[model samples]
Target: MFIMRNISIMKTFIRRRHIYIDHYDLSSTGISLNEYHQRRHSLINLIRNYIKTEQKQSSYNFTICLPSSTRLFMGPDVAYFPFKQQSDFYYLTGCMQPDALLLLNGNDETFSTNLFLSSCPMNSINDYERWYGPTITDKDKICQIFGIDSVHSIDKLNSFKIPSSSILFYNSQITDDTSTNKKNLIPFLKNFSSSIVCNQLNHFLHSLRSIKSLTEQNLIRHACQLVSKAFIKTIKNCKKNIQNEYLIHARFQYECTKLENTSMAFYPVVAANGRSNILHYQNNNQPINSDDLIMLDGGCLYKQYASDVTRFWPINGRFSSSQQQLYEILLTVQKDLIKYLNSGDKFITRGKLNILTDQYMIKYLREEFILSRTIDDDHAKRIINYLCPTSVSHHLGLDVHDCESISFSEKLESGNVITIEPGLYIPLDCTDVPSIYRGFATRLEDDVLLTDQGCEVLTSMCPKEINDLYRLLDERDNSDID
Candidate 1:
């Protein structure tokens, strides 16, 4: 999927291919040479609009500094975690390397993107190249490959004297300071120009990122589909009541990797029984007891896009009488909430979801004699959170929890992909809680894509229906008998 083109501006030029590793898929990422150009152009328009609309200036000239991965780590320095490009930087340049900077020059005459890279090691010049490896250091070749206007040495960035009153945008975390590892601009502001203006590119960039392009949708859909298959298989494996949480977690990883060279979006939460009461349970070491209700919170990443789907099921292949009652309530609330996510629907904020869910659940609890009939509105809401400690929905995409630049009451749009998760958790030691509902937790989550007509449940095939869960175990039993 990644290959350097033969021809370049330099006649018969050779690229240093050994040290340069490109794992990113351009087609899947909706990132290409053309896409980069379009993005650069779009930002140019955004700047122009900002200058005219807000600043009331003719135009706001600026230069953006986007640093690449430092590949730096704590402790062992064996690169403990895999190297991933900073999200906003990758979104703009799509360059995968260590110690590189993308400077987007936004001037009146020219809106050109420039690349600055650290020197690559060579065997003849240094011993590090022989032991460490060869990297892409060729200036012309780097330009040709990455589709940038100009390329320079990393040291040139150090000597980058900003123009007086120049707006230098740094792509770093949205902190009060403008420094994220290599792209520190504090020294530039303090030492160099007193009048130089600094700002973060977070909000401006997120505005574009929040909306998924066609290519992004395809990648996300593929990720969700793969995760769905893996989750179904993992659930079926648990029905025998012989597997531990780690085994199920391992099974999910194995299935995702075997199907397609994919990776986990985040660590799997194969919490069984009372362990499900804890929201972020990473320790999947417990055994699956026959009567336990297991919460399988797992997802996989395919080509950088992420998929998150969770299910609550019984180890014995059948929900207990108490489990069925609570599970049905959660399942019903989740299904009902989906109706409000359609395009033009009053934005399904966390607050709105909480209000609606609490009303429904409190009413159900009262009718079923689960909660005290004397329970007031506030207490009933607390009961709802007791079972489901997490929010009903969150944006899902490149990150498992994606596009945070959204308000809780933000209107639902066509391109948005969000998760609808309504869960119920009951701890074992809580005597205050009714005995029937204690010591079990169940959370059902699915990724939904908002469409013009309604919404498309991307992970719909994963099968949350009560019948589907039972049928899966039934099929497994039938297969074993054969």
Candidate 2:
């Protein structure tokens, strides 16, 4: 049985500014080792239920293999990109180090856990100490920290044995493929006889990951709040006098990084003026015009959870008549979508919302896009299709688009966090849209948590209201003028 023990006997090490204690404390990450243990237990039970109900097998042994992410360099002999652990690996074991493996082996009722990590002698002048600095090589420290049955050197992985009849749960997509077969796991399992059953581990893990624990929800909520505040600062920083899109991008980055263990969740979309017509426009180097609308889609990663949001405003701190009309319409539509999600009319799902998005867009396009003329149903459909071609929402969590394998058609359950992003894009060259709306693009996004009571908009603190956005920039503009 795996039990927490005193860490007095474990060794400690330090490299540069980081310290490795005998006991690994994960409090800063806002998740507990006990939660990780429960995750593993849940996965095991999930597998067990599958075998009993679907397979109808009385007895079976199974091994689940999860490998830590490996480091990758930018180019030949260059510095590596920041190391990001595979989400599923981090989910099961709170071990944050690279080049490690976790194995859960046992029969239907119980299992034993083993963690394999790269190790070097404590006092030796080996590669670990010379080039990379100190690593956690102490087995007892790791065992107690991660609540595993035992820890061993990764080099000994091939020597370990499991029941020949054991079902093997492994997903190569989630493991480091750059590693060799012996080190990577998919090939290591091949060493066993063909009688060893192979299963796609992602199936079980994604099902579990789709639901957010209260701890996870808090992490995401914090991330959303951070991004919301950062957006306000970014808008204020760039108002009136800012010249280029990259300056806006840099300002947002600076604001986000002021907090520890936080960074942009993805390369932000900082589109100015006509560039906004291109959805996913990340080449944030174009010069901003005084009267042009600036569209920003960005988020932050707090701990490992992600929050996504999008907002649009006039670069001059005041929207033009056309920009104001289009922005107000889209903002209203986005708010209505969020309200519909929480309406509890029926069991809702992303798939249904996706379909409803088109309907809603068409309705708005016909009723509001043109004040001088009323568009018929066929004309409105054509205009909506040409202007907006993206889905309204997707699930959000560890990865920006978390649980992608989980179908959008699946019901929206409590403890699930998702984003509602409705966007409108009108290219200058496209004649389908009215001339006044041409070359304008904008999206309003918010992270939402589905609870039994109702859906909570996690990013509401981020100002998406037209008047609020105006006030933020107007105050900055006034201060600069004074």
Give the top-scoring candidate (lDDT).
Answer: 2
Error of 2 at 115 (Å): 1.3
Q: State the local distance difference test value for candidate 1.
A: 0.70
Error of 1 at 127 (Å): 6.6
Error of 2 at 130 (Å): 5.8
Report per-prediction Cα RMSD to one decimal.
6.6, 6.6
- Model 2 TM-score, 2 decimals: 0.89
Q: Write the per-residue lDDT of candidate 1 for residues 26-64, one digit (tens) a residue.
A: 454445678777777777677667656776666456677
Where is the poorest 10-residue window by lDDT in model 1? 9-18
Consecutive 10-residue window with the lowest summed lDDT within model 2: 14-23
Please, what is the TM-score per model?
0.85, 0.89
- For candidate 2, give the lDDT of residue 112: 97
Q: Write the per-residue lDDT of candidate 2 for residues 263-334, one digit (tens) a residue.
A: 878989999877977777889999887887888899889998899999888877788887887777788788
